[model samples]
Target: MRRFWYLPLWLTLLVTGCAGQAERGDSLYAQLGGEAGVDRIVAGLLWEIAEDSDTRALFVDTDIERFRNKLAEQLCAVADGPCVYSGDSMRETHRHLQVTSAQFNRLVSSLIRVMEQEQIPVGPQNALLQRLAVMHGDIVAD
Candidate 1:
């Protein structure tokens, strides 16, 4: 009888502890400083991309404000935030661009620079990059 009682108690404690750890872990979105933080990071990244001679041409005819908003939405969604990215799929958006691996790498480097400038800790910055890097297949075709 005592063994049975202890079993349930142990299970309950285990579950409770796991739930608390989950809550404490939080989402990457929160770690990235939420929506405002995302905006700041994205803005800095776009600025870097525009100034990077190797990647500037990609945004030559783009509407920067709209791009910023969409990029933020996408980043927020990927970070498990509340935003919904309504932009076209990555493949569809980049299909005609014929983006090369070098170009893609340049953009990623710019993004990393912005993250560093934002003073985002290494863990969260790497986490965000990991999430974004999965889209390389869709964004890089050349």
Candidate 2:
């Protein structure tokens, strides 16, 4: 009888907690560890890209410092963090680069690896990727 009495209270709290999450759903940014996390992700990605032969040639002429800043800004903006992306549009940035689909996939793969190293749970990583995927058309020159 006492266990049954606690059931209703537990149900009430569960419902309230679920409702609160829905209302404050911007936790994705926090889940990524906020600004510091985004910055680390961008840095790790840059290092990965530099070392990965599949995508290294694409950035041969890129100004790395500028690329790093813009990338961090883009990640922050995409994750709904408190930063606006001030970089050029993907099409403009990739213009004249003839980025292959294979290269694009390699970049995505690199990001996944970096996120895993950053200890970002799969869900937030997927959410961020899904959002960023929308820009694929603008990035690949094919």
Candidate 3:
């Protein structure tokens, strides 16, 4: 009876270990459908931001295409995708611009719209958004 119990315990441990490893292997970006998916989401987000009069000023003087590509790359890198994020850090990048929390929240809302439009699976979307949500503190000042 003791030997039987030992075997079951060992099998349970092995199964649990394997499950944890699998979860660990999943990259945030890959879970978001890798590069192609991120591109779609970013494109939609840009469109929404462009149309919003309040947020439009933030992008004035910016080259839309370059900005879009940079954003996609950055998000991909954040998700642990294969791409490298060459952009400056959030604080360094936004320091001169003096972004406000309200503006940041609007931008995040637009991004959420894009994600919904793209129909990205919920689990990855939520996970990515959760990570991004934490950046509000550093990205938005005052």
**Candidate 1 per-residue lDDT over residues 1-142, each given as its tens digit:** 7658789889999999979968897789998899989999988988898688888887777788888889999999999999999999999988988889999998988888888888888988999999999999999986
Q: Give the C-alpha miss distance for residue 40 in model 3, angstroms.
A: 0.1
User: How good is model 2 by TM-score?
Assistant: 0.85
Query: How much lDDT does each candidate structure score?
Result: 0.89, 0.91, 0.82
lDDT of 3 by residue, 88-121 (tens): 7777777777778888888888887888777777
Whose TM-score is greatest here? 2
Ranking by TM-score: 2, 1, 3
- Give the candidate number with the greatest lDDT: 2
Clash count for candidate 2 is 0
Model 3 spans > 4 angstroms off: 1-25
TM-score of each: 0.82, 0.85, 0.77
| Tens digit per residue, CA lDDT, model 2, 94-132 | 989999999999999999999999999999999999999
Evaluated against the true structure, the overall lDDT of model 2 is: 0.91
